[model samples]
Target: MFTAVFNSFESGMIYAIMALGVYLTFRILDFPDLTVEGSFVTGASVAAIMIVNGYSPIIATLAALGAGFLAGILTGLLHTKGKVNPLLSGILVMIALYSINLRIMGTSNIPLLSQKTLLTNIQDAWAKTGIDDVLNGLLTAIGLGDSLPKTWSILLMMLVITVLIQVGMSVFLKTEIGLAIRATGDNEAMVKSFSAHTGNMKVLGLAISNALVAFSGALIAQYNGFSDIGMGIGMIVIGLASVIIGEAIFGAKTIVRATLAVIGGSLIYHFVVTLALRVDFLQTGDVKLITALIVIGALLLPLITEGRKVKARKKKRLMELQFDHKSLEEGK
Candidate 1:
């Protein structure tokens, strides 16, 4: 059970990156950028190709970000410059990126199992000299074995990345440019009235959003030891599910809390999915169904709450009307 939970958390760390990107586009920019599916595979393909060509893992990851940024720029241009609908613009770019991803990989998939991943190489070097064992012994001596596991290297790296991004996003959103970008989402006309170029803000916001997503995809490919073209299917839904779940379970009342919720939500989503798989009664083979159900539940939760509120309001109004009728009858 512990191993399974740990595995889900590992998967969640990778997805937390994507969830943050989704938060940028959907929450900050208020743009439904469906380009996520293509952008994700594009990042994975670029990273896999670069790794195969002997590039440094970090540099390769940056390259993936660039590729995703370019895709986002194309979508932005279509919507802003060409005056195309934002949804259609994203769809067009997403479609184009599918072919681009194929070209990047030169095939449908690229496996990195035999290659040296950033984390694996670090672990290998640490294990070679028994440094990890020594560290574990020290940790155990301090009575911290359960709190801090022996396999802490990768977790440490992922935690640093997540924290840095959460802090960076909080700070960035406070900047003038970031404020303008956020305003474009809140009220494009009002921002335009203030001489702010809402179009440019949308472009910049989307570019940044996809860049983070691509970076996440690159890291995921390395961690998973493979880049599969089909891996990105239903990604947008999963992202939405994570966002909704995070917001539902851990109300997004603050920036820091919201970002943490996204990461936590990703882990929760993975844990729940794994749990469903373990269930003996469901008899479900299609994992996609799980994704669909998660998305449906997330999408409906707010509506359900709203419905209850409306019903309560109606009930209260009827009671008031009944009291007024009773008072009128008493007067008669």
Candidate 2:
């Protein structure tokens, strides 16, 4: 159970980055950007291709981000500049990126079984050098040998990365341009009232959102040791699931709280999915069904809450009407 939990968390942290990008679109910008599937693959393909060509892993990852940004910008342009419907624009870009991704791989898949990735390199260094082992032995002489595992390394990395993203997003949303972007989502006319360039804000927001997504994709491909074309399927659903689950569970009343909720919700979602897969009753064949159900639940939760409120209002109005009729009868 401990190992399973650890592995789930590790995987969840990677997916959480993708969830953050989704939150930006669905939660903050309230845009249904289905380009995630293609942008994700685009990032993964860029990273994998660059790494195969002997480029530094970090640079390759950045290149993937750039690719995602460009894809997002194209989507935004289609919607805003070309007057395409927002959702249709995303679908168009997503379809285009599929071919682009295939072209990047020059094939359908690029397995990283023998390739050196960021994780493998780090693990290799730790094993090749006896620094940690030696330190563990020294610490064991006292009382800290049990605490010597580098378990904190992955956790620390996730924390640092998540914090940076959250802080950066928060700061960005506060800037004049960022505020305008946010306003564009809330009220396009209000944005125009401020004389803000709505098109520019939309483009910027979409680009940044997908850039983060691409970065996550690159990281995931490196960590998972392969960049499969099919890996990005249902990514938008998963991201929407994360954002919905986060807001449902934690309530996105504040920016920081909402960001944290999305991360937490992603990990929780992965944990639940893993558990469901392991359950004998659910079985592996039910994975897709389970995912679909989870997504449906997330989507309906807000609506369910709103329905309850509506019912309560209706009841109150009915009681008020009854009271008015009774008083009028008495007066008559």
Top candidate on lDDT is 1
Cα distance off (Å), candidate 1, residue 250: 0.9
With candidate 2 superimposed using the best TM-score fit, by how many Å does residue 323's alpha carbon deviate from the native? 20
RMSD of 1: 5.0
Candidate 2 segments whose C-alpha is farther than 4 A from its true place: 124-152, 300-332
lDDT of 2 at 257: 85
Best by TM-score: 1
State the lDDT of candidate 1 residue by residue for 9-111, as single tens digits: 8778888888888888888889999999999999999999999989988789899999889888888889999999888888898888889899999999999
lDDT of 2 at 77: 93
Alpha carbon lDDT of each predicted model: 0.85, 0.84
